[model samples]
Target: MVSKRLFQSVAEQIAELIDEGAYPPGTRLPGERELAEKLGVSRVTIREAEIALQAVGRLEIKTGSGVYVSERKPASLGALPQASAFEVTEARLMIEAESAALAAHNITDEAIDELETLVNQMSSDDEGVANAADERFHLTIAQASNNAAMVHTIQSLWQMREQIPEVKATYEAVCVHDAKSRTDEHRAIFDALRARDPGAARQAMREHFQRLLESMLEATERKALEEVQLRASQSRERFLAAAKFG
Candidate 1:
């Protein structure tokens, strides 16, 4: 089975092929089903790869028309800066902490009820629904702050988080691991807002992000260890193959 990382690898491979003129500019690439079969990956993986390539300006999707190779390419494959999950959490700490404080002062009962709904949704076992609910919860807090600028800024940050494939992938993994804790953190913030305690709200928001920071660091360390193990395994396989040949 193709792993999540393979989606990115497939995107890179498709980009390289485009650069080599396998699919020239304006030419429609194979359909998602065809690409999935050709690449030995699921169609969902193909879709994700196409989205990543499209984000980096390597491909263009047309409404009703097929996906086409872009005439222009990014300066390099590294054109998009990879934002670590830790960095995103840091930014959220700065922005969301204040937003929570303001929300404590300005939030309405209706908004509080909506937040409760979101929190419930986030606690569900369905990862997709939980992820969406989590995003909505944060955005709702920003909205409840009654500051349009804060809302816009928070929305922009979320958009930037999604645009970077690495960040998205890292957070997806983190969400799976930290979903229950994250939902509890959201409830803490909501409780503070319900009490109209600005200080408590801000502190809860900061604590939530602090936990996220630690989790992201742990995730990064785990990824590094996995990579090292994979390299060692490959090296051992090569050694065994060479010995057998000898």
Candidate 2:
């Protein structure tokens, strides 16, 4: 089946070539423009596809050199920068709100329909499917903005969201408890985009992140408290044991 995302499709093609030994491990691939021409895709798509491949350890990108196929796949999270969930949420609140507003002005009927389908997927009982849909829904909005920079920035933010262990854990904790709210917020954002109301779209996106940020804060505090309590209990147990020996 064809992949919905262009970059993903390109990445798959590149992986297939590597697997077929057309481009063996440690072999540097063609430059972006050359690869774009070969694949019939844009340079931006080629870049995005390479980044995706690198994230999965299928490829390695070197500055001042070129992209190379990796001999082994590494743990994805270990390669990402350490970012807290709060930091990522705050960044998304600012950037994605603008992205949503811009998308509202430029989004087509096709993108709107795609978002609606994604929202439905977000309602699925399978957590993995719903989470994947949520990611695509946001990316589709980013693409609809008709801004390459915005799409790249949002894609980076999403990489942090999915690949950073702490960020991923916090989101999972918050989302597991309030899946309905999460789905509803996405639907609100989609509705605003479909209506072509930039202000409403911005507000919806901002509100989504605002709630997420607040939830993360609450979860963090609760976690800290639980850790403190756990340590105190352990200390108390040690004290009682010593006292009994005395």
- Which structure among the candidates has the greatest lDDT? 2
Candidate 1: lDDT of 232? 100
Candidate 1 ranges beyond 4 A from true positions: 1-82
What's model 1's lDDT at 138? 83
lDDT of 1 by residue, 8-53 (tens): 8889878888888889998999998998898888775676677656
Segments in model 2 whose C-alpha atoms lie over 4 Å from true places: 1-14, 18-79
Q: Please give the lDDT score at residue 101 for candidate 2.
A: 98
Q: Predicted candidate 1: what Cα RMSD to the true structure?
A: 11.2
Residue 167 in candidate 1, Cα distance off native in Å: 1.0
Candidate 2 all-Cα RMSD:
10.0
What's each prediction's TM-score? 0.66, 0.72
Per-residue lDDT over 15-134 for candidate 2, one digit per residue giving the tens place of the 0 to 100 score: 898889999888899898999999998775787677677656677655335688877754444466677888889999999999999999998887888789889988899775687678
